[model samples]
Structure formats: C-alpha cells, structure tokens
Target: MKVLKFLSVLVVFAIIGFSYWIYSSLNAPHAHSKTNQYIQIPQGSSTGQILVKLAAEGILSSPLPLKVYLKITGSGNEMQAGEYLFDSPITPLEVLGELNNGRLRTVKLTIPEGFTRFDIAKRIAKQFPQNPPEGENAVLNLMEDISLIKDIAPEAKNLEGYMYPNTYDFQRTVTTRAILEKMVGEFKKIWKPEYADRALQLKMTPHKIITIASLIETESRLDEERAIVASVIYNRLSKGMPLGIDQTAVYIAKMENRWDGIIHKSDLESNSPYNTRKIVGLPPGPISSISESSIKAALYPATTNYIYYVLNVEKNDKSHRFYSTAAEFERGKAAYQAWLKKERR
Candidate 1:
C-alpha cells in the first residue's frame, strides 16, 4: 500500500512539472514569422513604449515573455529607433538583433563624368534632403559661402569645375557639405604634383589649366581628340585670335537663365568677359566640368600646326578633321552643315 501511494505522488509531481514547462514555452515571446512587414520605432520613444508598440504590431507574441527575455539577455536597453523592414515570420529575437545592429538601407548617387556642380547639387537634393538649397543658382550661392575651392582658385565665383564626377553612396540624411568634400577630395587625389609642375612648365597655373581644360571638355567628347582640340586653343592664343567657341556664349546665356538652345546673334556680341568669340584670350572662368584626359591634353597638346578642326561628317565617329588654314576647315564645316540639314529633314 505504501509503495503504491509513493508511486502515485511521484507521477503527480512529474505531471505538474511537465505542465509548467509546456505553459512557459507557449507563452515565450518570439520574433514574428517571416513575412513582409514594417516595424517602426519612432524617435524619442522609451524602451517600454517600444516594447508595447512591438507587441501591438504582432511582432511579439507576448509582452511579458519579451520583457523577461530582454531583461535576462541584457538587450532590453540596446534598442535603437529607426524605420525597419522585417521579413515575414521574424521572431522578436530577430527584430531585437536587427535593432541592435543599426541596419538601414543605403542610397546610391552616380555623378557622371563632366557633370557641373549645379548638376551634382540637383542630384544631391533628389537623394538627400539634408543637403543645401536646390537649383544651380542656390547651390552656387551655398558653395561660395563654404569657400570650398576658393584657396585653389581665388578668382572663381563657384566650385563648378572642381566637383569631380563619380558614384557615391550616402545615407538619406547626409549633408551637402559632406558630399561636396568627398568629390573634391577625389579630385585632389587625382591631381598629382607632377601635373602641377607640368602646368607651370606650360606657363600656366593649375587654375588656368583647369579653366582651359573645362573648355576643351565642352568642345569634344572624343578622348583621343582632346589633345587636338587643346592644340586649337593654344594655337588661337599664340596667334592672338579669338577662340570663337559658341559653348561660351551658351554658358553666359545659362547664367542669366535665358538659354533657349539657340545662340542669338546678340549673344555672340555680348560684352561679357566669358565671351571667347569676342575676347582674344581664355575665358575669365571655366565653362564646364573637365575630365582628367581633358586636363592632361591642356597640359600637353599634340605637336600639330593645324589651327582649325571641324566635325568629320563622313565618318561620324566623334572624330574631327584638322586643317592649318580656313579653306580646309570651311570644306569640313560645309560637309557637316549638309549632314545636319539632311538629318533634320
């Protein structure tokens, strides 16, 4: 009888213990199941508020289990506030892990070669709102206030040509100054000491070389023809002839926001110092963003006495035919004009 009674008591104790284990396991809070869901913890929310919000979002099965687990794991105080995307069926533990790790999506901004600072600023404004004011004029004003490129070119009114074009990864909250600094730093890295010496050897300052390079960049898109174009500019300077580049007139028109894609006769006759057709020397400032190859070409032009070049209409390979005199250039220009008319027709 005594043995049977002892066996019954042991069986009851075992049953009680098993029941308690099952209850604890079922009530334990866990991450939500893997499904597409957003878990947001607003800024300035307290730990308790965050836990409550998580529970209400169905990410936590039970707030008590989550609270206890957090306290036990010492992760209750490590939650960060941000917008988080949770994969479906994620557990509370997984959410906690993500929060602790501070994971956020990154945005990419690509600045192509020969992009002006105005273009770059527009790109930044689209990607990062924390950036400075919008539009080319507003961005130019902000750049002047920052003095980013003033030391390099004290005469420059804006950092238009200095903003090297490249791909950049930034957070949504990144500032304009930070983005500009990265681009300028990249430019500096590419601008070697030897290049500076070469500029001096050519009787030009780094600033002047950059300014001329910008003009060459705007004139030609063919990398192989940059040196030839550079020679044209140099030849014109040596002969005291006006460069007569129409892009300069376009730039002047853009400054006044009066550009209409058509260069008016009066625009060529404008008294602006930037009017290369009216001026006998290089423009007072850069006309556009310059590539490294353009800069190199400006520093070391090809050994050619050819003073003029026109688009090669027959080839259409982005190559230009050079001529030492006006007659040959006129022939090339006539061919180009015929081709343009045919295309338009």
Candidate 2:
C-alpha cells in the first residue's frame, strides 16, 4: 500500500514538471517564429526606440520579454547602430546578439553604363538625400567640385563622363559627395599614365577621349559594338566629317526637360556645343557616363574601314550593322524605320 502511494506521488510530480516545462518553452524569451527581414537602427536612435522598431517589425512579440531578456543578459548597454538583416523566426536572444555584435547588411547601388550626370544625380539623391537637394543647379554644382572631377577632366565643367558606372556598397548615412568621390576616385585609379600618352599619340586629349567614350556609351548597349561605334567616331574625325549623332540632341533636350518622345528638327538645330550633328568633330563635352569598355573602345578602335552604323532593326538589342557607304547606311535606316512602324502598330 505504501509503494502504491509513493508511485501515485511520483506520477503527480511528473505531470507537474512536464506542465512547467511546456509553459516555460512557450513563454521562453528566445522563442521566435517569423522569416527574413531588415531592421534599420537609425543613427541616434535610443535603445527604447530600437526595441520598439524591432517589436513593430515583428521580430519580437512583446517589448516586455525583450527588455527582461536584455536586462538579464546585460545586453542593454551593447546595442550598436547600423542596418541589420534578420532571418525569420529568430529569437529575441539572437537579435540581441546581432545588435550587440553590430552585424550590418551592405546596401548595393548599381550605376549602369551610359548614365548621364542627371541620371547619376537622381540616383544619388535617391540613395543619399542628406547632402543636397536634387535640383539641377545643386547637382551641377556638386559635380563641378574640382576635388571630384579634376583627376579625370580638369578642364571640364562637370563630372559628366568621369563618374564610373559600377555597383557600390554604402551605409545608410553615406553622403552624396562621398558617393561621387568614390566613383571618381575609382576612375582615377583606373586611368593609367600610359592612357594619357596614348591619347596624345592618337592626337586627342583625355577630355576628348572621354567625350568620344560618352558618345560610344550612348550609341550602343552591346559591349562588342562599342569599338565599332568608336571606329565611326574615329573615321569622322579622320575625314573631318561632322559626327551626326542624334543622342547628343536628345541629351541637350533632356537638360532643358524639353525632350518629347520624338526628336524635332529644331532639336537637331539647337546651338549647343553638344550638337554633334552641327559640330565638325567631337562634342564640346561628354554626352553621357562612359563605361570602361567604352573608354577602351575610344582609346583603341576596331580596325574596320566602316564609317557608318545603323541600329539592327530585327534584333533591336542595341547592336548595329556598320557600313562604309552612306547608301548602305540609308538602306539600314529604311529597314529600321519599317521596323519602328511595325512596332508602333
């Protein structure tokens, strides 16, 4: 009878222990059940603010348990400031560890090849608005800062073609000038001293090379075709023929925000020095942001005798078919026009 009573008592204790274990498991400070998310702890945010943000993002179920956990673990004094990416279902304990350790995810910004200064300014404004307003005058003034544009083009008024197009990683608090400086610094790092000598050998200045590169950047999206486009520019320069590129006119029109869909006759007739159609040689400045491939093409053109190129209508992949005669170019243009009409329909 005593053994039976003792067994009954043990059974009662076992049930109580199991229930306590289940309750503790459910109410544990580290129990998390959500997925991937990014939490940005803004600069100068207090610990309470950060905790509230985390709770709001569903990283924590309640601030009470987190505060208790933080107090118990002595992590309240160790929260670092930065952007952090958290995996779903992460416990408050894990998040506390992340905050204390200051693990931050890098934000990527891609600057595409052939982006103009205006496009670049818009991009910068989107990424870092703490520096200046995105107005054209402000952007232009920022671009003209000699400390940024001097290495690539000292004589140029703006850092038009010098802002090297590439992917960059930056923190949230990074300023606009810092971003531009990094891009221009990359350009300077890549601009070899031999390139300047080579430019002189080609009887062109570095500014002129950048200008031609910008034209090539705007002319073709296909990296393989940049050299061909560069050859067209070279051929025009060699023959003293005007480089009749329409993108230059569009660029001018865009500066005044007057660019409609179609390029009017007056657009081609605009008196800007960037009007390659009216100019006898290279544009007065770069027409767009030049990529490394375009720069290479400008420095070393293809050995083809072709002097003209028209967009390939069938593929429409920004690739062009080059020609040595205006008649062949005219035929290509006719094909392109027909393709354009069909596309419109």
Candidate 3:
C-alpha cells in the first residue's frame, strides 16, 4: 500500500508539472527582444524547421512546448512561408497565429515631395538592409531605367523627376527594381491625359513641364504662391534671362553628391546643365520630385510679368515679393542681404 501511494503521488506531481509547462508555453511571452523582431520562414520549410529557426532568432525560448502546442492545435501544417514580424513579449500562440495567417511583413517608406532621386536612393539603401542589399549607386542605376516613363517622358535621360513622392507600402522582401516601379506607377495616377495636352499647348515637352514643376516645388513652401513662383520662372525664360534660382545650385550639389545645405560658389560656376543660375531655360531634367500642385502651376502660370522674387522680410513667411525690374530686385536683394547679415551676426 505504501509503495502504491508513493507511486500515485509521483504520478500526481508529474501531471501537475506537465500542465503548468503547457500553460506557460501558451501564455508566457517567448520573444526575447525589447523591440519588435522578425523571423523569416522560407517557403516549404517544415514545422520542425520553422520552430528551429524561431529558436535561432531568439523569438522562441524553448521550441519543444511551442512545437507541441502547434501540433495539438493542428496549426503546424498551416504555417506559411514569408517574412514575419514578431512583436516582443508576444505569447507563443500569437506568433503561431501570425505565421498561420500568413501576414506578410511590410514596411512604410515615405518619400517627401521635392526629394531628389539622390535623396530617394539613400533612403532606400537605409530602409532595406538586405533582401540582397543594394548600395546607393546600384539603386541609382535602377532609376536610370527610363522605360518606366518612356511614354510620358520619351526624352528623359533617366527617371529622376518622375518618381512620385508619397507614402509607399513595401513588403520587406520586395526588390529594389520593384519599389521604383511602384513609385513611378503612383506618379502615373496623378499625371492626367489633360496635363499632357496642356504641356503640348505650352510648347513644353512633358519632361520639361515636370522639370519646371520641380523648380516651383522646391522654391515655395505655400501652395498659393507656387503659381507666382512659376510666373517668375516663365518671365525669366521669356526675357532670355537666366532663371537664376539658387535651389538649382543645391540640386547640382545633390547630383554630384556634395550637397551640404549651403550653395558653394564652385557649384554656381560648374557648368552642369542642371545649374539654372549659369544656364538659361530649364535644367537638363527635373531637379527634384514634382507634386501635382506644382505641376498645375507649371501648366497654368499666373498672368504676371514679374520676373524676380525675394523673401518677404516683413511677413517672415516663406512667401516672396515679386519684382518687375532690376531696380526693384536690387532693393529687395539689399534688404535680404541686410537681414541675412543681421541673422548671421
């Protein structure tokens, strides 16, 4: 009787211990990272292989219990292959659910309006470390595939101005080429057929319209003032005067990869076709990403003869004072210089 009782007590303790372990496996958080972590299960990986990878990634502390849980729930065979994001301190059940549901891991990448291809390249390089990692130059070369814009910009040297700026959703495994294509696709949605007609009426190529729009995009902060800025550009171009916008110098700096926020005298003097201060008419292409508002302004410039604009010092807004003559421009220039000097002091 004593031996039988001892055996029964042992069985009871064993059952309790097994039950506690199962509960812990189901309820306790398995992921060890302080931040969200990712575990990729390749296509056709077996349940055992998936568990082992989860263990290797430190997402699962002990694979045995989770493995048993998956098997018990008949979820083992349901685990699909893709990049899976695991929230830290997530329960094992949650991990299993995410994998079973085949929720693809996606990343949000925002390309701001007016960002150049140079800026876009750097951002892409940083955002995706390596689904076969690519460098900035490799991505830039990808942008040079002008086929994406062949219909709209047949003469485009590259896909610089056509990369529409907006928030984009990308699967973590998306290729670099695929990403650029999607962004260009977004731009197509905004580039209406009517806009192409407008461009023809203005005697501007679609590419040149986008280029001028890019100039207006970077020149003004307020939407209402973009038309005014576009008018200034048109007046300068009509009079056979240099567009002389300083941001073109910044654009030149970006293309050559030396952009440091300040325009260098060397940049102004360098005879790059993108440099508007030295070259008359539009740059070789769009200097930055173009927005639809700026595109509209380029298509229908306000009927103003004003050929110059200086920052409006009185309002301290990004708004500018439009001038029609050299004398008016000189006075505004002097005031701007005085303000700049005082600010520097």
How good is model 2 by TM-score?
Answer: 0.80
Q: Which sequence of candidate numbers ranks them by TM-score, best first?
A: 3, 1, 2
- Residue 15 of model 3 has an lDDT of 88
> Candidate 2's residue-wise lDDT over 171-283, tens digit each?
76676777788988888877788888889999888999989988988888889888888998898889999899999998999888787768999999998988888889877
lDDT of each: 0.77, 0.80, 0.88
Which portions of model 3 show Cα errors greater than 4 Å?
A: 1-35, 55-58, 85-90, 131-133
**Distance from true location, Cα of 129 in model 2, Å:** 3.8
lDDT (Cα, tens digit) per residue for candidate 1, span 1-345? 999999999999998886675456434445564346556677688767887887788776655655656665676677887767776555556667777776665568898766655566667776776555655456566666537666566777677677777787876666677777877777777778898899889998778888889888888899999999999999989999999988889888877778788999989999999999899998877777778998899999988888888888888887889999999888888989999999999
Highest-scoring model, lDDT = 3
Model 1: lDDT equals 0.77
- Number of backbone collisions per candidate: 16, 3, 0
User: What lDDT score goes with residue 121 in model 3?
Assistant: 92
Give TM per candidate. Answer: 0.81, 0.80, 0.87
Worst 10 residues of 3 by lDDT: 30-39
Candidate 3: residue 41 Cα off by (Å) = 2.4
At residue 192, candidate 2 shows an lDDT of 81
List the RMSD of every prediction in angstroms. Answer: 4.9, 5.6, 3.3
- lDDT string for model 3 (1-345, tens) is 999999999999998999799888878975476345566689989999988888878887878888877777776888899877788887878888888899778989999998999999999988986955478888888888899899999999888879999999899878998899999999999999999999999999999999999999999978999999999999889989999988889988888889888888998888988778888888888888988999999999999989989999889988999999899999999999899899998
